[model samples]
Target: MSDGDEPAVTGEEVRNVADLARVDLNDEEVETFAEQFEAVLADFETLDEVPEIESEPDLVNVMRADEVEAGLTQEEALSNASETEDGYFKGPRVS
Candidate 1:
């Protein structure tokens, strides 16, 4: 949508986005982001006017063959760990 047609983004909306993104933003930052968001929407409006190209390159999944190769031995793998438990690296529990 054009900037004129775009709905105003309030400080509450910016704050909500910060919360969802797991970031903290003060009131001034929220107001600044709201203004920046309006500018970004205006830039998007310009992009909407660009003509679509018919010969765009299609994206394809590129992968390599998966083959088994020699890897570290049990002793070598656990050698660098600060602690080991039953031939495995012992680390702090995630939970």
Candidate 2:
């Protein structure tokens, strides 16, 4: 679509953003994106008209229970390690 049929979001801004994003866009694509961006912004602006809630709703934990479970044994865990010591994987010591 041409910029004439598009809303207020400018093609220059779209092109600038595309440049910033390292996107390779031609003239037609920039104009189309500028129009789309304007429409999207208008849609999001409707959220501003929604009435504010007076109080917060109760919130609760929604997670799985944590429990100890059997996993790979020490020897199995360190089987791929280049070095192991005292049933633990060994790595270079850092100061």
Candidate 3:
């Protein structure tokens, strides 16, 4: 339950969990997984020692100010199109 303590998971518990998850486990696998689970949980307990810090990040306006700009005319825009209908790019029917 805590760091530096033996993992409390048992083979029976592992077997029960495996059964619930529809996983087939033999006695050997159950024993192996019980030990593995304990080691994993013990590793997780070490995370408790990580120092907590402010969650907020530095706030800054990194974006450039918005400005109106000249855009391509309809003729220039449609010039590259493989197909155009009524001054608009024509795509294939979807339905």
Cα deviation at 65, candidate 2, in Å, is 13
Sorted by lDDT (best first), the order is: 3, 1, 2
Question: Could you tell me every candidate's TM-score relative to the true structure?
Answer: 0.48, 0.53, 0.65
Candidate 3 regions with alpha-carbon error over 4 angstroms: 1-7, 53-57, 73-75, 85-95
User: In model 1, which runs have C-alpha deviations exceeding 4 angstroms?
Assistant: 1-7, 56-95
TM-score winner, 1 or 3? 3
Candidate 1 per-residue lDDT over residues 1-95, each given as its tens digit? 33576557878889899999999998889988999987787788889999998996988878887999999999998888999999888889999
lDDT of 3 by residue, 1-95 (tens): 53546457988899899999999999899989988898788788878778998888879899999999999999999999999999999999999
Q: Give me the displacement of residue 15 in model 3, in angstroms.
A: 2.4
In order, the Cα lDDT scores of the candidates are 0.86, 0.85, 0.88
**Predicted candidate 2 versus true structure: per-residue lDDT over 1-95, tens digit per residue:** 23576557898899889989999999999989987998888777877778898888888889989999999987788899999888887889998
Candidate of highest lDDT: 3
